[model samples]
Target chain A: MKNFDVYVKKQLLEKYPSMVFFLVVMLFPHFGAKAFGLFFIMLFSLASDVRQKRLDLMTFLPLNRRQIFWMEYLFLCLLLSTTFFVGLPFAERSIYAWLVLVRSFIFFSSYFGVIISAVSIGFDPYGAAFLFLLVDLVLGGIGSSQLGPTFNPYKLISPVYQANLLASLVFALILIYMAYRLFTQRGGER
Target chain B: MIRVEHLRKQLGNKQVLSDVSFTVEPGTIFALIGPNGAGKTTTIRCLTGALQADGGQIELFGENYKNFSQIYLKERMAVVPEERHVFRNFTAKDYVQIWSRLYSKWDDTIFSNFVARYSFDLSQKVESYSIGMKTILFVGLCVASQADLLILDEPTQHLDPTVRLEIMDMLKECASSGRTILISSHEIFEIEEYATHFGIIKEGRVIYSDSIDNAKENHRIVDKGENLQASDVIGLVGSSVLVKTKSDVGRYPRLNEIVVGYLTGHHERSLSLR
Candidate 1:
């Protein structure tokens, strides 16, 4: 398992430098906080594995399928956590920045889980990416509209963004669990 | 010894392997032969434990493979898959080093010797090596591991005739050293020359498997009399005898006579011909 981890990390490090450069250019300075690009970067990197068929190699290894899945999740989480720490000084030294960072990581991880599950079921990476973007945009629009004039802190519709973030985290967890189940089931037959 | 019993697998609606079973003893090279889409690779995948068998069991070295840990089983085995997928950026030496760490029995001296003998450029990235060179490196890794069981699928798929023969000789040498080898290939003639045992799979089943000499003796293409149809024969000693051709009242009576004469040696010559 440790060797496998080292192999994955080695592969990532070999490609991450160039990817970070591309991400930096695409989502330049002061774009809804630098951390916004981190989510996209994580998603793209995970999706890149799907596109290249590197994910298939995991199934061939001796480790449990679920264990492999969680390792991938942890690796992504570590990347997100590192990005958050690096961006902490850049964002104003306020609790909001920290909260946003945590919330974003949770939301991004959950979304990634759902997307990876979809990919496992024969979803094309580009199509899945496009669909994810469209769905997020629609949900974000709906939530922003609900948080319109005269926002009440105690109302069901109030604190709309936070509620959406919480919902995203819940859905992400569910999707990841489902993805884990699906991969394990398919792996058993392999 | 390696024993596979009732191994079965399905992918989507297609049944890849059904009730596949075979046993390979130590110091012997077994060739698994089949046409394309005949489930050769799928069966190999299951035996290597890369893919799970939907049903059945695989015992390697007198123990259930599933009961053993991955590292434990993998330490004693190595595979050279049909498609050689080496890490593109890593040089041949780096690939060897990485695999060496994975297999406890890996021999660095043997690896270095093979590298030198094969004239592989350790400095060049694996991606830069030609297909044949990549195959050489893949085989080198298997050899260096010193694993008791070596499973290869189409190991010579992309090599020139000379290199392919060299690889086959290497496998023979490995087997002679008391290791077991199970290889699947479409190259029948090459397999016929080196393999001690033969397992011919067709459409996900082991239609025929036995020692090479026994298989030859068992699957004879007997040409009978023009009026005596080949399909009409019953209680034949072998599995199946494919009839290549049959003609009536032709110049081939001597051929039929020759086959009948051979069969008489095994059976009662007094039996009346129809």
Candidate 2:
């Protein structure tokens, strides 16, 4: 746990400037544009091991590949989701809007985090982004399928229903778990 | 403290590590040396678990590598990878603090002493330091971690002669404390002074490996003008031949000579005493 915390600090500190810039961008009213940029910047940040090519180095530290992967995801989620939830004032007034807001936050972050795990396992991030874009457009079902009436930031923002926040959270958690399982089984080799 | 057997890895179309094997007992400094592309880095990668080996076994501290807990193995070992392994944005202080907190064995006295010895401001960003300075900082922290085993690759590359000597002395001290050290370096002469064992690689295969004393005993450089014909004709001078003969009559080959001879000389000889 201590090692993971140190790793999180190092990862965030390494990309501090870009992270700060993205956070500032999130504060603007252009939620759609900001989120789009967020996808690239956040995913690029996922390449924490790419720059130093230190996947091997990290193995020498007191952290497993799974722990390292989890911390990175956690760092990105905490950093980006905080920005996301801060925009909740703009959410529409609907039945249990607060539940919807929290659910959507968990759901979208995990969804995209799973999508980026491929990049962590050797897939080029830009190429992964392109593939992700293709899949999201083609399947039209796995991600943000129903842009509910209460969607605030964008007409395409996947909105949560009344008390279904638990379901949404459960769904994303399952996907995240599966992603981590597959990642570790591969031995974290690029 | 370390054992590798028949480790093999194929990267894309090339066989980067083919049948590599070596063992390092506690308190020994083993130098892994080879020509460029000889798979020194690949071997280190496999041992560190950075790259999974396609075949063979590795045992660290008598624990089968596959069965050992990742955190347990990591806590007992530390590595200074090839190049650019530093967090550029972090100041020296930040880098040290991170490792200090992560490892229970971290020696604050050593860390502070190293910082003072290096005489660099801890507040400066790591990227702002020269490459040599970066090497000093990284090596200092790894030493401070006080791991049971230390694996370093090209650790002294950018360092000056003075710093390199200091670093080598520090590593020797580390080994004296019962720690094991595995180093891969091109600075053959420098390592020869401190390394107790050697694993010489040639085109991805381990050609020569043994305790430095045993290596010296098992291999010798026949005087160039010797009248004897030997099987391993490793090098040739103006009027003499360098032979890897086990003959007690010939002088022991230095580590540098053995490395060159294995990489370039022929291994065919018929003995004739001078």
Instruction: Find the candidate with the highest lDDT and give its number.
Output: 2
> Residue B176 CA error for candidate 2 (Å)?
1.1
Candidate 2 lDDT tens digits, B159-251: 888888889999999999899999998888887888999998876777778887876676666665565554466655334455655765567
Report the number of clashing residue pairs per model.
3, 5
Q: What tens-digit string does per-residue lDDT give for candidate 1 at B120-221?
A: 888888878887788788888888888888888788878888878888898999999999899988877678667899776766776557787654443334
Candidate 2 segments exceeding 4 Å error = A24-38, A51-54, A84-96, A99-117, A138-178, A185-190, B67-69, B223-244, B266-274
Worst ten in a row by lDDT for model 1 chain B: B249-258
DockQ of 1: 0.21
- Residue A46 miss distance in model 1 (angstroms): 5.2
DockQ of each: 0.21, 0.49
Kindly report, for each predicted structure in the order presented, the TM-score of its chain A compared with the true chain A.
Answer: 0.72, 0.65
**Global lDDT scores for all candidate models:** 0.64, 0.71
Candidate 1 regions off by >4 Å? A22-47, A50-64, A143-168, A187-190, B49-52, B60-71, B224-274
What global local distance difference test value does model 2 have?
0.71
What is the TM-score of each predicted model, taking all chains together? 0.77, 0.84
Q: What 10-residue stretch in candidate 2 chain A is worst by lDDT?
A: A153-162
